[model samples]
Structures are given as structure tokens and as C-alpha cells.
Target chain A: SQTIHQWPATLVQPVGSPLSLECTVEGTSNPNLYWYRQAAGRGLQLLFYSVGIGQISSEVPQNLSASRPQDRQFILSSKKLLLSDSGFYLCAYEGADTQYFGPGTRLTVL
Target chain B: AQSVTQPDIHITVSEGASLELRCNYSYGATPYLFWYVQSPGQGLQLLLKYFSGDTLVQGIKGFEAEFKRSQSSFNLRKPSVHWSDAAEYFCAVAPSSGSARQLTFGSGTQLTVLP
Candidate 1:
């Protein structure tokens, strides 16, 4: 079974601050990875997805960007965080037609 | 484009009672269907999925979902509900044979189990 690990389970940042969240997958190689954001009382929104190293696709244009430096490592970053960016961010890896999710990161922008 | 619809935004059921959550989907062909549960401030946990073969799929935590191709629905059901089952449930669908394996999720149904 593949395991996904996301760091900084909870984050608190000020408006206009830079942001970085990391996601790493184990027991899988060259897997499809995705980033989704869920706001309060809202559905999950696809932010970005990566097929392989150095390849990233943005689903919704925003202040956030994604990078896949390694086959199993994906990073979501933003130069300046917006108050609307505050939400629960999730990382997922596709395996055997199934996308498994990580614990997720909760971001609070003040 | 594939889409999922969970009609019930919120449902309240008594503990030990039977429960059912409705889900409908739209796609060009038979898509992969999935059910996931999320607790407050937590990530989604996969409950069950249906790719092919049997239309009825069993999942973790005593949950099961039956896929009806004729009706384009995949409804989750449990014979006996527990207080721990109180959480938000989401229905999702993905293309069966596409390079883009992204899932389209519904708005979600919040389940509340009364004591």
C-alpha cells in the first residue's frame, strides 16, 4: 500500500506572507498527484496536479503554484497568501484507479 | 466532463437505525464511482469504490454502496448506524480510461446520528 505524508498539519500565516506545503508519497513511483482545497462549508476544489517531475497543471488560476521536484515529492507554494486562500489543503496520489489522500494541512490566514 | 451529485446536504438518523445516502452521476460511459467520509478537520477516508463486475461494493466501517447503471446512481447504505458514523460523506467519480485521473466530487452530505 502506498502512503502519503503531508507536513505542517496546521499552519497560521499572515496575509501577504509566503506559503509552502510539502507532500511526499511512499511505495509508489511516477504516480499522479493532485492538490485540492476545501473552504468552510464548501466542496473540494482542484488546485493543481502533476504527472511527473517538472510537470505541473493548474486547474484553477490563483496565487498558488505547484512543483514536482522528484517523482514522489510535490510542493504547493504561494508568494503571497490571500485571506481567501485559507482552507484545508489535501494531497492525493492516484493508484490503481483510486486516489488516496493524505492527512491534509489546515491553513489559517490572518 | 464527469460529475457527481449528492442530493442530500444533511441527514439526521437515529443510532442503530438503517441509513442511506443518495448519489447520482453523469458521464459519457461507465465511470469509476467512490464514496468517502470526512470527519471534522480531517482528510477524506475512502469508504468504497466500484469499477466493474459487481454493482454492489462493500466498504470499510460496515458500509456498502450499490451502483445502478440504469439510474446513474450509487447510494451508500448501512444496516445499523453508529454514533461514530456521524460525519460528512462525499460521492466522487472519475473517468474509467483517461490519462487524467482526477476525481469530481459532490458537495457532500453531512450525516448526524442521534442517540
Candidate 2:
């Protein structure tokens, strides 16, 4: 069975600080990876997705970026965090049609 | 562009009562529909999905949704609501596009089940 894992279940960052969130999938290769953000009481917004290593497609232009370094390792990073950037971050792997989610990371910018 | 619309922003129901949440979509052609649930501070879980064949699809957690092509709507239904079912529900549409396999999500509806 395939499983997804994300680190830093909760994070507290200062404004203008750098941020990194990691996501890795086990038992699956060549799976499509995605990074999404959910605003407070809002829907899930797609930030980036990678179909293969070194190929990242950004859905929404923001302060964050994504990179797929390995077949199952994807990372979400930010050069400088903004106050509005604080939210729940989710990493997902796509099956044939359905997408599976990770536990998600909560970042609070103070 | 293809999009999803979940009309209800919030729904409140008593435990053991019937439940129905409306979801409508705007797309040009046949599109795939999905329902997901998100608990507080947790990731979004796929509750159900509709591709073809059966109009009504059953999913985990005793949830079922019916797809109506004419109305472009996929409404989720449950025979009886439970306290555990209280969470945020999202309706998403997946257009048959390239290798991305991306999903466009709705604003979501927050369900509050009264005990």
C-alpha cells in the first residue's frame, strides 16, 4: 500500500523568514505530487504539482515554490514568508484518478 | 475554465436525521466529480468519486453521492447523520487534462451535527 508523509506537523515562523516543508511517498514510483494550501475556513488551493523529478508546474503564483528531488520526495519552500502565507499545507499523491493526502502541516506566522 | 460550486456554506443537522449537501459544477464537457472531507488540522480525505456508469456512488464513512448530468450537480446524501460526520465538505472537479491530474475545488461547506 502507498502512504504519504509530511513533516513539521505544526510550525511557527516569523515574518520574512524562510520556510521548508517536506513530503515523501512510500511504495509508489512516478506518482504525481502536489502542494496545496487551505486558508482559514476556506477550500484547498493548488500551489504546485510535479509529475516527474525536476519538473514543477505552479498553479498559483505566490511566495512559495516546489521541487521534486526524487521519484517520491517532494518539497515545498519559501524564500521569505508573508503573514498571509500562514495556513494549513497539504501534500498529496495522485493515483490513476483519485488523490491521496498526507497529514498536513500547519504554519502560523507571527 | 472548469469550476465547482458548493452552494451551501454551512449546514446544520441533528444526529440520526437525513443529510443532503448540494454541489454544482460548471464545465463544458463530461467532467469527473469528487467529494472530500477535512477534519480540523487534518488533510483532506476522499469520500467519494464519480467517473461513469453508476450515477450514485458509495464511499467510506457511510457516505453516498448522486451525479446528475443534466443539472451538472453531484449531491451527497446520508441516511442518518453522526457526530463524527461534522466536518468541512468540499466538492471538486477534475477535467481530463494532460498529465497534471489536478483538481479544482469548491469553497466548501461546514457541517455541524447537533447531538
Best by DockQ: 2
lDDT of 2 by residue, A14-78 (tens): 99999999999999999999999988766689999999999999998788989999999999999
RMSD in Å for candidate 2, one decimal? Answer: 1.0
Off by over 4 Å in 1: none
* CAPRI-style quality class for the chain A–B interface of candidate 2: medium
Q: B-chain TM-score, every candidate?
A: 0.98, 0.97
What C-alpha RMSD does candidate 2 show over the true interface residues after superposing them? Answer: 1.1
User: Could you give candidate 2's fraction of true interface contacts?
Assistant: 0.79
Worst 10 residues of 1 chain B by lDDT: B94-103
Q: What DockQ does predicted model 1 obtain?
A: 0.73
Clashes of each: 0, 0
What pairs collide in candidate 1?
Answer: none
DockQ of 2: 0.79
Which candidate achieves the best lDDT against the true structure? Answer: 1
Question: How good is model 1 by TM-score?
Answer: 0.97
**Residue by residue across B1-115, what tens digits does model 1's lDDT show?**
7778899999999999999999999999989999999999889999999999999999999999999999999999999999999999999998888776788999999999999
